[model samples]
Each structure stands twice: as structure tokens, then as C-alpha cells.
Target: MALLEVKNLGISFGGLRAVNNFNIQIQEGELYGLIGPNGAGKTTLFNLLTGVYKPGEGSIFLDGKNITSYKTIDVNKAGIARTFQNIRLFKQLSVLDNVKVGLHNQYHYSTLEGIFRLPRYFQIEKQMNEKAMELLKVFNLDGYSHYKASNLPYGQQRKLEIARALATNPKLLLLDEPAAGMNPNETAELMETIQFVQKEFHMTILLIEHDMKLVAGICEKLTVLNFGEVLISGKTSDVLNDPKVITAYLGE
Candidate 1:
């Protein structure tokens, strides 16, 4: 069965249909791309998948269990995690602590235990620190683990956000325009990092990216959306070459 599947998904705002009849199946360990023009509801679709918005119709399944309208926290617990197009880190917290936030669901101690620094709290804290560090190292941010999250440069900030999302141990990782503010060098590095995530974690990733080069470089398949509807979906090369897409989206 597909690791992540959406059937007849849709949503609207008053009279505007923001997303309509969307459907897709993403297999485990596959890197999938979602692309479209601005205001094409790409991020809105992510919101629906992550349960930030309850769809007006249809269901979403992860690992074959329905999670259509699960709460955001519940969705994360159910194994879906995502990063925003606009980076959303805990600015005042240490980089390590920012990642620890993601690890919170997996590690636990009672409120009193945490407040009193009981043995269990320290034990769990240690394990979480170790795990958070490992995720930081994957993004090459371990050396700056003590710095405030707001202090990181833009590219590293992007990596930090992805690292935090990965800390959740998700079955499906959703990245919304992760390369949005990157330079060419940074975008190139991001391509490598995405491939690394796929191989090292055997992750299923669905990303919304406007950078065709990045999408073509790492994505195994592609889906195009226009005006909240699917235009086409197929192999990367085929979708990129479709005449309708070229004329309407690529403008080539």
C-alpha cells in the first residue's frame, strides 16, 4: 500500500475553491514534487495534509490508516511532519532546544518530574539531547547547537527547520518551498540534503518547490497543480515536457 494517499481531497473559502478533488499516492521512500504558479494552492494543500485545515471533502491515509481530519499535534504523532515555506523556528531558544521541541512527543517525563529535575526527567532529557544532536549533525548544524535559533544564517536556518521536522521520526515529510530564499549554492546543497534524507532515513518526502532544477534533480515523480486542480502527474521528465504545462506554467 502507498505510504501516503489522498483521495478526492478538497477545500474552499467562502465561494473560492482553494483545493478541489485532489488525489495522489506516494510510496514509501519516494521523493515527490508538487508544483504550480503562485496562489495555486500548493501550500494550502500542505495545510490540508498536515491537518491545519479540515478538508470539505475526501480522506487522507498514512500507512493505510485514515487521518483525514486529525488535529495538527495528532497528525504529527501519527507520523506526518512538515516545515513551512517561511521558516518557523523558536527564535529565542537554543538551536538544540528548537530540535528538542520536535523530540518532545517521543520522549516524556511527568510535569512534576520535569519541574523537579527528577531522575527520569534527566534520563529522558539526555536521550533527547543525543537524538537532537544527531539530527543537527545530519544538517551540519551540530557545531552551532548552543546558538540561538535566530542567529543562524538564512541557509542554515532552512536546514535547521528541516532538521527539526526530521526529529519527529515521520513516515512522510512535507517540505513547503524549502528552497524559497536560497542562493544557487544553497539550493544546490539543498538538493544534496534532500537525497541524503531519502537514502539515509528511507523517508517518503512530498515537497512544494518552484525551482525546477531542484525538483528535476531529486524528485522521482511530479504533480502539477493549477487553480487548485491537478494539471498532470507522471515521471519528472514527462510532466516537465507536457505541452500544456510548458504553455501554461513553464512559459517555454
Candidate 2:
């Protein structure tokens, strides 16, 4: 069975359909790509899957359970997590603290217990810190764990956002334009990092990226969208060479 399934999914604002009749099935450990020109509804689709927006039609199933209307927090608890097109981090917080915030859901102690310095709270906090550090190490950001998130360079900030997302222990990770601001060298390194994270975490990834070379290089499957509808989907080579995809990119 697929790890995640989107069946005839769609969303709209008043009369404008932002996404239409979208369907995709991602098996466990698969690395998939979602691509399109600007305004192709890729981000909109990400929002729908992550529960940032509710679908107007169709259903979403994760691990065989319908979650078409699950709340955002519930979705995170269900093992789905994501990073935004623009980096989102707590600027003033240390990188370590930013990651720990994502670990909140995994920590079971109550706020009162933390305030009172209860034994259970202390234990959970220690565990959370250890886990956060481990993730930073995996991304090679352990050396900067004490730096504020806003102090990191653009690429490092992006990595930190990803590290923070991984802290949620998601089974399916939705990455929106992870390499958006990266230079060629940084993008190259990020590609490897993404693959490493997927293998290390044993998770499925669905990424929305505009860089065709990067998408073609790493993603095993590709889905192309245009004006909020799927133009084509298949092996990367086939989809990129398709006439419709060419037209979509050129016409824009």
C-alpha cells in the first residue's frame, strides 16, 4: 500500500481553482518531486497535504487513514511535517532551541511540570535536547548550535529549517523549494543532504522545486502542474521531454 494517497484532491478560492483533481500515490521510502512554473499550485497543494488549507473536494489518506480535514496539529501528530518555500525559524532563538521547539510534540511532560522542575519534565527535556543535537549533527550544523537562527548564512538557515522539521519525526516530509536560495555548490551539497536524510530517517519525501536540473537529478518520479492542474507525471526524463511541459514552461 502507498504511504500517502491523494485522490481527486482540489482546492479553490471563490471561483479560482488553485488546485484541481490532483492525485498521487507515494510508496514508503520513495523520493518524489512536484514541479511547475510560477502559480502552478505546487505550494497550494503542499498546504493542502499539510493541513494548512482544507481541500474543497476529495480525500487524503496517510497510512490508510483518511485525513482530508485533519487539523494542522493533528497532521503533525500523525507523522507529517514540512518546510516552507521561505525559511521559517525563530530568529532570536539559538539553533538548538529552534529544533527543540519542533520536538515539543514528542515531549509528554506538562507545562506546569516544567515550571516546577519536576523529574519527568527534566528527563524529557534532556532527551529532547539530545535528540535535537543529534539531528543538527546529521546536518553538520552541530558546530553552530549555539548561534541564533538569524545569524546563520542563507544556506545554513535553510538547513536549520530542515533540521527543525526533521525533529518532528515525520514519516512523510513535504519540502517546498528547499534549494530556492542556494548557489550551485550549495544546491549540490543540499541534494546529497536530502538523500542522506531520507535514507537515515527511512521516510518518504515529496518536494516542490523549480530547478529542473536538481529535480531531474535526485527525484525518481516527477509530477508537473500548470495553472493548478496536473500536466503530466512519470519518470523524470519522460515528463521533462513532454510537449505539454515544454509549452507550460515556455508559455510562462
Best by lDDT: 1
Among residues 3 or more apart in sequence or in different chains, the pairs in candidate 1 whose N, CA or C atoms overlap within 3 Å are: none
Q: Global lDDT for candidate 2?
A: 0.93
Q: Please, what are the lDDT tens digits per residue for candidate 2 over residues 107-175?
A: 888889989999998899899889999999999999999999999999999999899989998999999
Per-residue accuracy of model 1 over 1-252 as CA lDDT, tens digit each: 999999999999999999999999999999999999999899999999998999999999999999997999999999999999999999999999999998988898899999999999989999999999999999999999999999999999999999999998999999999999899999999999999999999999999999999999999999999999998999999999899888767576
TM-score of each: 0.98, 0.97
Model 2, position 221, has a per-residue lDDT of 91
Residue-level lDDT for 191 in candidate 1:
97
Scored by TM-score, the top model is 1
Q: What are the lDDT figures for the candidates, one per model?
A: 0.94, 0.93
